[model samples]
Target: MASICLGRQPILDRNHNLVAFELLFRQEETEETAHVTSDLSASANVIVNAYGKFGIHNVLGHQRGFINADPDLILSDIISLLPSKHIVLEVKESASITLEFLQRCKELKQKGYQFALDNIVAINSQVELLLPLVSVVKIDVLALTRNQLTQLVNQLNHWPVLLLALKVENQEQEAHCRQLGFQMFQGYYFAKPEVMSIKRADPGKIPLLKLLALVMQDNDQNSDIDEIEKEFKHQPGLSYNLLRMVNSGSDGLPLKINSIKQAVQLMGRKQLQKWIQLLLYTSSQSADSLSDEITQTAVTRGKLMELIARAERPHDKNHHERAYMVGILSLLDQLLGIEMQQIVNKLGISDDMNQALLNRQGRLGQALKLIEAKEKGETASIPSLLSELDFLSLNELSDIETQVRGWTDHTDATVN
Candidate 1:
């Protein structure tokens, strides 16, 4: 099998909720051109890799996935391999839209497949023809003027197809699209932090941070456990969640834990620390209500970094934990709506871990850079980063990513 690199970009609804992700992939050798000898073969490989190798639920969770489809792939039987109800077949505007193509798309639609017209610049004959067939029409807002966009949206109003603003880069674009009645949006806008007058951590999260500090203390004395249990006593919600999580058997605890003290003893400080870190994300909000994509992104990064550290160091457990911590903490600034230095100062992490989170300067930092690059679809930078690691190969890294996806998916389910 060819070494294929996979990437996903989130698509948000009008309310800025994560609704789906646009799944992207390219063969290792064809990174630049993204040219495949056979479109059908490449598409088949993507489906097999995403559904078979990566697992659809792992990659998509409960959300749908937008997959690009050329006419050949759209018309072929291979497309049926995907869960039709959970995938949106994104047909590019460049496809040869003939009567046969229309018929094939209609046939698929009848079978529960959804379609989105990709990179639509103007409402021409092709756009007009496909409007009724596709559930969505992705407008290339970057390519059009404000007047052109308004005109296009007006023309598109004839059909009930959802208007999706593509390549929206900032809040300005998102706001404009929402004002223009675009129902869905795809871009980096959500990842960008909103400007706020005061940047402070949420009050509810403060106790979780304190508990994390107590759990992560380096002292081996019994008093460390006492301090942790004391903190948990003050926060009944946190204690209940801890016991509930352990009882859920997601932590692989041999027996049920009834109290915070028992949890600390059986799970150990390291595992306890891990649970606190994750709990920080879900403590105040219900699992289902924690809809921010950044939380899932943080968890995925942490697990990937942890797995990579395990692969490299093998027996160095501390290094693995630090890697996971750094990966997750790297995004705390955006998550908490505060500065990275502020969060670091509150946690009082080691200098090395601090550097990894703030500056991306250490071994953990390098791992984070690789993960970020993969997330942003910067496939070109992957080779150099892999070379810098020196202990991992592209195939190995891909496998690690596959593992992380599945692990994070399971973690999300357990938390939910």
Candidate 2:
């Protein structure tokens, strides 16, 4: 099957709750923004991969998904295939506001499908006509100044449609949008850390860090397992969760594990290491917390990095393991609210992994850079990064991404 690369960005409500995701069609392998020659074909691919290959529940869970819709898609029968209740079709701003376009939107609205006017910079006759039909209006916040944004918000206040601030890049922008009465927001602001020098890693997480370091160490003596088991004993909750995860394995364990040692033995060091990394996200907080999205993002990154490494090295298990570690650890600073350098220092990871995590250097570092670029929608830089890793083509990266997304979605569902 041809690989599909889909990029997703979280959309938060006024309360900063993850209420939806803006699913973007990415064409990282090609020179054009979309591999398909036409926008209709591009939209078709996104809908198929999201709702078919990945499944809606895996992609959006219980939250709604905001998908881009050009005029062609908006007026087509294919749009009806999307579940009306779970989807919010975003009408592209560049779409011509003809009478037929407006009529089609009204038809979709009557069928229980919601529409959002995408990247609205100013209120005009076209926007006014569609306001009543759309349930949401996504304003291009980055395109306007503070005064312009406030003025636009006030103008939009005349309508019943909810205002969504698009391209929000920082907390300050989000606050401004909230003050301006934007009900929904889409951006990378949530993932970016507000670093504080005084912030330290949670004391409870220190042991998990040590356990991670020990597992990644070169020493394979039985003493290593004893030390790991000892650490888990010190944290009974971690031990119990480990056992639970093993028992609940999709491929059922051949033997029941009665002790931490047994669980460790059954899972082996590699799998145990991954579980401990995952526990770093779940053990400290509820699954419904705001950090849930961040945890999911980290897991996705880790899996993508691992797949890329597998494709590149093919035979180097250690390199693949480190790639996964780099991807997961890349976001630790955001999760822990501490400087990444400090976390790396504490983990005592190898120098290559350290460079990858802290500076985005080395082979693994370039892979991390590619993932970051993909997340930020910097598709222009992707081709060059792919060039650096000549062994793996863009099609391979797309395939790897599709596989990683599926794995991460499954892992998130299982972990929760």
On lDDT, the leading prediction is 2
In candidate 1, stretches whose alpha carbon ends up further than 4 angstroms from where it belongs are 1-4, 28-38, 191-416
Following a full C-alpha superposition, what root-mean-square deviation does model 2 have from the true structure? 17.7
Q: For every model shown, what is its TM-score relative to the native structure?
A: 0.44, 0.45
Q: Write the per-residue lDDT of candidate 2 for residues 23-59, one digit (tens) a residue.
A: 7665443322333334444555566546434445556
lDDT of 1 by residue, 295-398 (tens): 65676787788989999999999998888878778877776666888788778788889888888777888888899999888999999998988899999999
Residue 79 Cα positional deviation in candidate 2, in Å, after optimal superposition: 1.3
Candidate 1 lDDT score at position 209:
77
Model 1 worst lDDT run, 10 consecutive residues: 192-201
Instruction: Enumerate residue pairs that collide in model 2.
Output: none
Cand. 2 TM to true fold: 0.45
lDDT scores in order: 0.70, 0.71
